[model samples]
Target: RDEGLHPAIRIALRAITDFAIPFQKSSKLYWRYFLVPEAEFTEEAIPQITAPVIEVKKAKNEVPEIKEELQIIKTMPNEPREKIEMVISEPKKEEMLTPAAKEPLIKNPAIEKKEILPEQILDKKALKKEAKKPKPKPKKQKSDKKEEGFFNKVKERLASKSIDITDIIGIKKDELILKVKKEKKEELLIAYNKRKITEGDIIEAHKKAKEADLPYSILNLSGIPKKIQDLIEALKDISSIEKL
Candidate 1:
């Protein structure tokens, strides 16, 4: 032979017969999804094949499998699982001054508030010291005392003259005319004569006496001495009296 086989291998190659694959006789390791069997159809079974229904069978203890990328690992049945602990870190004291993005969290207190004062917090001692300070009394002027004295004297004199003091209106500048009836003037002279002489010659001496007809007659209203000279010189330097 031209090949490397001996002369006996060349004679055995001439007796070959079948080379077709036997799928039914293959091992289980050689199975594939492409080899699944489909339903056959005949003329009588064509109507049943046109509307075929599919049913899936499930096991009682079947658990759904998860993909390997989810990082889940399977362990032995007697192995214990470790406890997962979480760690939360506290922020530094310096970082709290200027918070993140210069904005404060809603749960944090932004500022401290001052306490308010209660009512009725005033000092009682201060109020008592102010109350103990003496208030000034008003002093009376000298002119007021003099006016009161003159009014009292005038009221006493006018009240004793049988004159209604309320009717004594005012002074008329010491220059107004006085009105006296003639009979009253004669009676005034007679009264003056009685004040001067004895009782029996009093009525006769005034009838022979020369008459001085005056507008007014003052009959010695002062009960001190009943003198005609004091009546003429009474209250000479006094000015007009004022009303209260």
Candidate 2:
């Protein structure tokens, strides 16, 4: 039948069929789409990700480590060429000088001159003569009498009032006046008369009141030492109060 067609038309049709693409038998356009497989939803396999490796280079200016001991050597030319040896020893403590050795080393010129005097260089007979001479006693000073008289009066008052002032020795007049003023003297004397106060009790009372920082004064104590009052004011936690 192709022999009935023109030669050019035959050639054209052969070329068109050769270049055309053939569709599947189950294509949607052919009404057989159910026979075709549904479009697939697939998960692709993932390769593990890793960080790249990096190499560090050492600095060229780095100093090399030393592995040797350091030492010092000294030699003298004029000295004998003896075998030199190294010795390691602990330091030794210097010994104290004896009295016999130290006596000659005294640096005082007066003492040296005194040692050369004829009176200092005594014989056994002269020593015996000096030993036989009567020894003189140290004279008592006048201040000792004044101290004794003051203590005697204090003792008399302590005995009459039955107050223990044993711990109150060596108290000067100024100290006594500070503890017991002239105005407070009558009050202290009255307290003593009632057997409620002792000689050194007032000072102890003041110390306690100052330390505790109580609202009320102890035994009506007043006129606290300026040094103690300043210290109390300097404290952060404790509140300052009127001097007492």
Candidate 3:
């Protein structure tokens, strides 16, 4: 009657309680306290074991069936079978002297093409003329000029102030060439000074900007002259350079 427990467990408990051994029967008080009545348990239970009934089944021999099949196979008449073979021979290519069929055996197109003489395909006069004719020189490619930026004049003016303009020219040119917003450029310069941005970082940022279809040109710090770098280093405050 315990709904919380499995029916199989309840059935097992009931079976143990109902079929009492000599010792269990003698202990009336213990059985009365612990044993559950069979009527209180559910009839539905799993495979039960009571008496051990062993069934011995004799194995059937398949030898008689096999012998019968063999006899049937032997009684069957022998059927005649035909063997097949294939032989292929290429036609001999011999010159025919007869008026009809005088042409040689038809050759494979690939073989005929390989056997063709160079003289048959090329014109001797044309080959000689081509050899004698001078080859025209490759024309030098002129690079397209880039449009000058609005700050190009300002960059050039600042660059002229440098004692040796050769080293500073590249940096000046980059300043003019960069297409990024003025604020972003200032931020990059600040980041560059702080070592947050490197040459590789600038290049990678430029690539990412280009991929995103943004107008930006990266600066190459290494392109600046050592003299200009030294001058900047000597300067007490770098913020003053931002004015220029």
**Candidates sorted by TM-score, descending order?**
1, 2, 3
Residue 140, model 3: Cα distance from true site in angstroms: 61
lDDT: the better of candidates 1 and 3: 3
**What local lDDT does model 1 show for residue 180?**
23
Relative to the true structure, how large is the alpha-carbon lDDT of every model? 0.31, 0.34, 0.36
Candidate 2: pairs in clash: none
> Which candidate order results from sorting by lDDT in descending order?
3, 2, 1
lDDT of 2 at 61: 22
Q: Residues 1-244, candidate 2, lDDT per residue (tens digit)?
A: 2222333333333333323222322211111123343343111321223322321112112212111111222233443322112111111122113333223322435433444666666676699999999898675666566555655654565467554432332234222311222322311221111224432555564554455443212221233446555755677566656877
Runs of candidate 1 with Cα error greater than 4 angstroms are 1-91, 99-136, 141-144, 166-244
Q: Write down the RMSD of all candidates, one decimal each.
A: 39.6, 46.1, 35.8
- What does the lDDT read for residue 83 in candidate 2? 18
lDDT of 1 by residue, 126-148 (tens): 67878998988675676556545
Q: Estimate each model's TM-score.
A: 0.18, 0.18, 0.18
lDDT of 1: 0.31
Clashing pairs in 1: none
Query: Candidate 1 or 2, higher lDDT?
Result: 2
